[model samples]
Target: MAEKVLMKGNEAIAEAAIAAGCRHYFGYPITPQTEIAAYMAKRMPKIGGVFLQAESEVSAVNMVIGAASAGVRVMTSSSSPGISLKSEGLSYMAGCDLPALIVNVQRGGPGLGGIQPSQSDYFQATRGGGHGDYHMLVLAPNSVQEMAQLTIQGFALAEKYRMPCMLLADGTMGQMMEPVELPDSAPEMAEKPWALTGTGLSRKHNIINSLSLTPDELERWNIDRYARYAKVEADEVMYEEYLTEDADVCVVGYGIAARVARNAVNAARAKGIKAGMFRPITLWPFPKAALNKLATTCRAFISVELSMGQLIEDVELAIRCSRPVTLCNRTGGMIPSPEQVLASIEEAAAKLN
Candidate 1:
């Protein structure tokens, strides 16, 4: 039986991770996401799991790497600046092909910008934050409900692909309260044949390292990883479309901004305007095909965001510049209102008329 519970997104993420059998969590407390660490600190010990408050984000990510290398499901989380610190570790995990979950409850900034919701980390996440060519299977949630769902999915995808997966959220999604049904079909984690959990049969010792001294070997490794990434792109694109049939205007966004765009779409529909929403759930895989299809039907596309038009570039590229793509956004902890989005939609509709 599935139980319905009202929870903040952060609480739901922690609870869902526990239910998914995550036994280790290491993180440093940060704004809009501290509740996750706090929740785990209180609950992990009771459940016979490990929770450590590391000294810094770098240390926290390294701790997760250590736990994951031991063949256990492990995780850590942070906001923008902290995520920046964890980039080195993230690349290490990706390079070594460690299965771990990382959550970014995004806030504004290139620096310690603000403790408000922002999608400024889109490029950082999709581009693989640190260095080297790698990608984190990134999931974006439009609601608190989806936030819980994606956290669990992040772990699954990470383990399945032997890569780090990220739950890319924002302060709005993290703090919003919503009713969610926990997953009923939780699978038991399979034995990790590759994990270095002190192999009993010492046929050969194991090592997990991101460093490659030789150029030829490193090039081959990069090629192999890109092959894996290609498979991921082909197999993993998730998104949602609302009233897209014969639409004249398409609103593209994710997380909190996407939810606001939903309302704006409905309002525009009420006014007899053909409006729709194209929300990307997997931010890295980024529903390009859907956006292209919508571009064929809609006269214009509006890339609504909580940051200054970061996702707008992707939307334009996906549609191949066949139609005009406009940007509607706010920055530095400010949330664009539904009315404001509706006005943007109205303006776009006028451009078509």
Candidate 2:
């Protein structure tokens, strides 16, 4: 039997990556997320893995690109401000189809926001933070267990899709502690036949780059990438529904806000209000089909977040105005409460009746 241990979310992410066979990690120091780099530093040496603390976030992500191109499993961790610096590198990884893991223990954003947890980076993670037509597979975990499990799985998804992946966790999730049962052993990594390891005596050398200087070639490359993105969307859309079947109002949220919304649903139900919660586990795919289906029945929807209604855009897009969707959020490091979500639900439900 695997022993369960209480762990903070950020530390869990680090251990989980190591257990997922990640032998290399390069990341700069950042608030609310430094634990990830610290853990890697403490453990990687014992495992004979490379744990490099680069001079800056930009340097760190670029190093990851170099390592990943050589066919090694690699990762990087940062908060919102640091992530912004790495955006260009993230874009390059996407363009070249390199598989790497990027963990953003989100903090208030725009610029050196704050160390406190915040969801302000929702758009950047889901909308391809870099300047290109590529999408990174995003996993949003609301619990310590999922934090570890998702960290393990993010690597596989990135390798499977041949692209970078972001594990979008808020500061609260990273700082909080909970019991988690980690994997018994490192997961088996796929063979990188396309990796640029070496061609010593191989028939041909492997090339990795996001650049296609020719316009027509770049267009073809982009079109092909979108085809793969569509496939990922079809296969990877993930979300969780809580008592939404007969509810009059559905509250949609993720991460910490989702946790609060769950409590709000329970309280609303106790008060005889038919309310439910929908958690989008994958922020990217966004689970449009399931949400659209729910919109056909629910009287209204409330999109909750720790940011000023950033997620509402996706919720509105998902429902296509089939139902009225309102936002209940807090920004600049403020946390959302269950009472606030319930109030928003009551407000939305009132509009319905």
Best by TM-score: 2
Could you estimate the TM-score for every candidate?
0.97, 0.98
What would the per-residue lDDT of candidate 2 be over residues 42-108, giving only the tens digit for each residue?
9999999999999999999999999999999999999999999999999999999999999999998
User: Could you list the CA RMSD of all candidates, in the order they appear?
Assistant: 1.4, 1.1
Candidate 1 residue-wise lDDT, 1-353, digit = tens:
44788899999999889888898999999999999999999999999999999999999999999999888999999999999999999999988989999999999897999998999899999887898889999999877778778887888888888899999999988898999888866556756777887767765778888889999999999899889888888898999998988789999999898889999999999999999999999988878888888887788999999877789989998999999999999999998899999999999999888
- Give me the candidate number with maximum lDDT: 2
RMSD of 1: 1.4
Q: For candidate 2, what is the TM-score?
A: 0.98
